[model samples]
Target: MSMHRTVTMLAGLLAALLVGAPAVAADNGLTVLAAPPASSGRMRLQVEVTDPALQKELRSSGASPDRFRVAVDQAGAQVKAVDRMADSSRERSYTVLAFDQSKSFATSWPQAFDLAEAYADELGARSGNHTVAVMTFGKSKSTHCEETTAAGLRACLARVEGRGTDQPVTRLKFYIQEAVREAARKQPLPRGGSREVIVFTDAGEESPALKVKDLARDARERGVRIHVVVFSAKSAGKGIAQRLDEMSQLAEGSGGRYIQVGDVDARQAVTGLVGALENLYWLDVAFCGVKPGQTSDRLSVEALVGQTPTAWSAPIDFRQRAEGTATAACPGTVVMGPSQAQSGTSAQPGTSGSANPPGATPGTGSPTQPGTVTGSPGTGTQPGGALGTPGGTQQPGGGPGAPGVSGGPAGTPGADAAPSGLPWWLIALLIALGLLLLIALLVLLARRRPEQAAAPAEKPVPPVAAQPAAPPPAAEPPPAQPEPPPAAPAAWKDPFATLPETRLVVSKGPPGLEPFYRVHKSTFTIGARQGEMDLAVNLPQLSGHHATVQLFKGGNVFVKDEHSTNGTFVDGRRLNPGERVQVRPGQIIRLSQHLELTLVQPGLQPAEPSSQVPIAAAPPSVPATTPPSAEAPRPKARTLYAPARGDDE
Candidate 1:
């Protein structure tokens, strides 16, 4: 077949594979909004017929037609309308014909964005209660979106900076973080007010210098939502979609959302962004005792409906199960540890539990002597301490070493102290039994039955004595099966090989002249040469609604400071109260020493471009809230296929 034909066939196969799912056209036309960024104003739509045969067939017959609808909702009122028609026979596909053109019943796919744009217009018109920050670097020259609603919003674009042409993700993240925070804090947005931080940026970030964790925390605390709309693609011929994917990761990681306007018409991009924000599920969880050196593994929670597990959330570790009572596995459980492979077990709903780590040593739950573990009470220095070995010291069986075991120091003596190592009791009992058996054997020999002697002596003497017994050919025991060459030590393999890379996008620390800049994934390890080391970390905020910064010198958290506003306080004192605040890791530091920020990282998995999981902040009964339909029509949405509910619990 001709090359073009071959290509067409492959495309057809791929499209068929993707499009076979059940059709779910809403009986009620979907409302859509098209709010493209300010600079990429106007919009266009295109529809292409890739297959020559399909095009020829259409030419011989007639043009293929398509339809689109839009809707708008404010408060309890909702309005719906049909915006346009799409014709696919005239050109290769549909191509952008005009900007801001309105149609009735048909025209092209571009109209989808236009209707969505109209929806955005209506929402934007309502006196915006929250400030939307627009930050730009290397080009913007300090302009805020709130200042000029139409132009500022449209100007949401990522500025190219530095010498290298490649879009460094670090710079993009820095710009977005600065813009969002400045915008949210610029105006005294009242509590519970709607706010957004929209960034028009390239998807690249350089070696990170900013603190992302503190910034993310602050945004969540201030009730300021974040959104990123990218205008450029990676310089390496990468698709603009890839850039959008990265932006979405950062935004969603920080409890916000993002979109790419390059591929989709500007209208669609804007509409989708606004609509997604409206329907997002933002939840918070408060946790304590998650200090440094403490186990953050095997912890998970779920919100269930009777027996069937519904929404579940777990820590990064794989050993934890939800505190739910459901017999069925939950779909929302998240593991906090390094592994995603986990075994599921039934547990009470709404409660959490951890599977004890294999061979974990039981600790005394008390401070060890200074020379012992690193974090012991009296240890004066840094570097190394009395903490367990790298392989993790085994504790007592029922004490600190047991699985899911917590509370207490290592080395505390107890009946279950696993420090005894390999269970000597079994060996001792075996030896005692062996000695008893030996004595019984001797007794049996001394009491042989007399009948055996009388019956056997005559026959053996008559036959064996005469022949000198040609030595009976020695019988050989079966050749010892050569121990199967120990199966080549299972080739070392990384469980996280398929996982996407985690990028650190934001960070924060105490303002200083000689500041430390180290961005590792979503965390910033902050410290100076002399002063105590500090860190700005981005922790997943789930139903718990709280995250903390813990400082560990050796093996224990000497100081724990909370950055959560609205009561994340320290030592009985509420710092920011309900707002995001910077709490010290230890009691000694003040706001100047203690630093905090909301950090942004890559999606938990590559498939999930948006790390923000859908967690309901309100009860399920609270009406199905869709984004303003007019702003963006619901195109066929592609959601990451999560594991079957309860498969991982």
Candidate 2:
């Protein structure tokens, strides 16, 4: 009995060991280093294996292409494709390090920069052909390095400072768009390569200027992955937490990862980012039954090595090229009856086959036979009149008669008639003589009127007794003049007391000083008209009334497009005509291709209300009634245009 029990226990232990060995071996230290965005029909991924032993094992096993299985599930439809890339010989990697320089990020500046440097170094070591760039954003965007080698990137990082403004606001969305645009300008990667943007920020403040959805779309279209690293000390604070959530949504939406490194060291943070890149593997996916330009089904991709599978699923859109259609040719010329001659033929009198005699003239032939009349070209009479030939002369005294004959008139066979009336000049002279006699009679009556007035002015004037003037009464002291009412205080003590102010900085024109405008009024106009617009932009691309900035009574501000020709852009999006979008303090308002302005709230806090002084009591006195004075006319309101930097007026 004891020997049987021992054999059973040994068999169970052997089974357990066998099951555990595969799980341990499956952890071959392979990680995704970079992943291309999954938008088009195919996706390319970059994967690396860190363990030297596992690399050797993979080589010795001679893992065939079939070992890597790829499948996609799109809109409930599953598709399978081949794994085309097995090595990274011709791969190129791009990395953009974006730093957030808001006030909240100042505390973590040192650690964040160190981590970025380390990340760059690791990327360079893994792939010698990799390129790197750096961008910094606070109230605006600044490009430090663009498409440079790893060493050049380091040099650019060394010059970076934590000298950002105290305001916690940052234009995160604009910076993201700018980074993607910069990345797209670089040379495209090889068939199996990848692009990545690693953003290091505390993400404490949100930008109201742009939408998160738009940023994600731009990144996907550019085929770039955006990985966000939250490295600020206060990243867990309530405000910062919300910002982090937004950042995470952006990362996930673009098929990238969001890592919270608030408590981790620089190496750990960098390692997490690198690991995500190493785990990516490329697959050449074929969408079965999908035509070019047709709306494709939602697709999902799953890559399997042995029995382990990594799956990526999303809906994709494919652009269709326009197809040309055939058009019918227009008829060359109009077709007449069968008897008609061909086009461009001259008419022949005798060739028409008429029944007229051989020696007959064209128009003088008798019309007794039907074919004789057809021989002459213009012998047929038009419907309304008896005129037969197109240009035949009329008879001397004919009235509604045939074209070639004379008609009887005044009861005779062929007599001419004369008109019976006096000439127009004799009648006109008689009317003029009557008008002259009437004028002379009126003038004679007017001259006798003055003589009649002189005869009626003989009435007499009666004499009046005059009273003696009394002595001047004692003069009374002039009444004291009321003091002019003190001038009323201005409605707003400071123009920028409550609302945010935006400074228009010229990016394209000749370099000079920029101008700043305070948004004090409820409604402000922006246009090219000098006196009509409050914030006048002189660039030719701007329309007469480009846009309007409105500050609501509730302390919120908005921007409305005024149907400008070039267009008004909030962030990078063009606003539809008459569209009104809320304006955040740090948002960018682009009036034209050449004119771009950023809204900035200068100080950290709004201005405080001014204090009021108490008035002392006054002695009471009897009131005297005074006549009311006329009210002064109100002055017309005028727009205050923002002048250029050097304009004296």
Candidate 3:
């Protein structure tokens, strides 16, 4: 009997060892999770190791922080930074559960609703810090429960019911979009926290109103992970398969997962979701070779735990750093010394003088001081005064210099002495008087000559017989008429008048019946309002006064955005509100997504020349034939035709 007891004890010990081995292995498994919606430039991650044993071991081992390594790969570029959060608490997570209440989901409504409630309750129980929100979409979207506690979420789910039995068209894309929008409406998760959305739907039909690709893009842009659960009773077929593929893409694009269920237990789906969420470990990494708001297509992460290296890769979207926030990892400030050479004089060998010289302006002395004075001369001294002299004397009759005056050699006058000659004004007056007397004498002599000549001419000579009057000089030939100035070239007509009139054609509208508008005015308005716009478009997307089209005098057409809610686009580039951009023929103008027009100038077809009537030679000598009627018709009056406006004058 004692031997039997020993054998039983050995069996019990063996069973205990087998059970503990799996637990130990699980404790060693490393799972890394990153916050979804990658940022553009540098990203901060919070890293966690789910295994409690490993955490305790790491703490006790006193391993260097370097033991935890994080590397990021983006668009073929790789970077590595130390993981700083290996010892920190687990990050908080915010989740939003979106339900589809469209008609297609009516059959599976009860199960889907129950699954959502159970998932919410589980998440709340797992972590009181975790936040949960519930949203439902059908013909419209409504938030049944905003972020709240576990109890509140359960109560909200209980009251939720299918909208109605009416089979309204399913807008799957719209519902997905609303879900992401609603998720983003909540307060953004704290730095290093995770935000995600779980969508429950039947995947029966998709709405044409929204594109699946667009929905995915929006979710990704908002950084909200979308987890999709397609609960349906329909058998797997082409339609169902397509729906599943699209839903999977939507989830993966936003860094989430997709699950499909039919008739089986729905709890499995919820369990899988919860497991994924709970197992996530935050990874904090530093990025290099990318600027804030700059994105890279390829991003991967790897970690080193002890000696083993484990890696996880996904398309990384780096977050834009806060505008004024300083990077925590940057090196500390360094004290810098003065850079001026003069300031360093004390440090140099054999330099004993102060930076500034004695009796000199402060901070104004040069390193190499001149022995002789370099400033301007004193006020009493001339600029050319000799060095070392207080004031120099001026030589007699020489240009003035400094204060003292010296006499010129022997009889020469000093510079300060006055001249001993007659005044200059008196001498000038005498010269003027002498000239006036000479002028009077010449005038008297001229008057005497005229009197002598008159006495001599008193005797007259005998007159000769009158000569025949000269024939009147022949009249000069008529003055030649000035040649008429060459006629000025007819003023060139307005160039735009000849340019083919441009027209806007509705390229996306009905075939063979597209709307056309001739560009008659220089400026015209375009918008949705009938009375306000010259070209009115009755579409919801277009603003009341969306934009303006202007035909410039030079024949160029331009469009200006008018601060519309949905901005205008030329070709494919969006125009800044209130911006004007030149447009060319064949370019597309999009006032909104649904309304687009093409600018066109039809080619001018050359006109065929009309055959000219041959002029008949006058009939040769044909006798005039009288008509039998009483009187011949009066000769028709010659008719004149004025040229048309555009025709040659």
Root-mean-square deviation (CA) per prediction: 31.7, 33.4, 33.7
Candidate 2 yields a Cα-based lDDT of 0.49
Off by over 4 Å in 2: 1-65, 68-86, 147-150, 162-168, 187-192, 235-239, 272-279, 291-296, 305-649
Order of quality (lDDT): 2, 3, 1
Q: Write the per-residue lDDT of candidate 2 for residues 540-646, one digit (tens) a residue.
A: 44566789888754456688998765578888899987888887777788875667777755443443322221111122222334322246333332223443322
Model 1 vs truth, CA RMSD = 31.7
Question: lDDT (CA) for every model shown?
Answer: 0.30, 0.49, 0.49
* C-alpha RMSD between model 3 and the true structure: 33.7
1 or 3, greater by TM-score: 3
Provide TM-scores for the models.
Answer: 0.29, 0.39, 0.39
Q: How does residue 407 of candidate 2 score in lDDT?
A: 22
Q: Which 10 consecutive positions of candidate 1 have the poorest summed lDDT?
A: 69-78
**Tens-digit lDDT string for candidate 3 (1-649):** 4444444455544444433322211222333334344443344443334455554555566434434433322211112343333234554556777777766667777878778877876767654556777777767666766655878777777777544324465666777776677656663534544567888886656455666666665665555677887764432333453455567677766667666564235577675565554444444334332334433333333333432332223333433342222121110010011211111111110011121122222212122331111111111111222121112233211222322222221111122122112245644654554555456556556655754434445678799999999889979889889987554433323323543466777776323333656554566677656545666555544566778888754567999998765578999899977888889999999875667789976544211211331111222232234223336332331211111122211
How many angstroms is residue 332 displaced in model 1 relative to the true structure, after the best TM-score fit?
Answer: 22
Comparison by lDDT, 1 against 2, better one = 2
Worst 10 residues of 3 by lDDT: 343-352
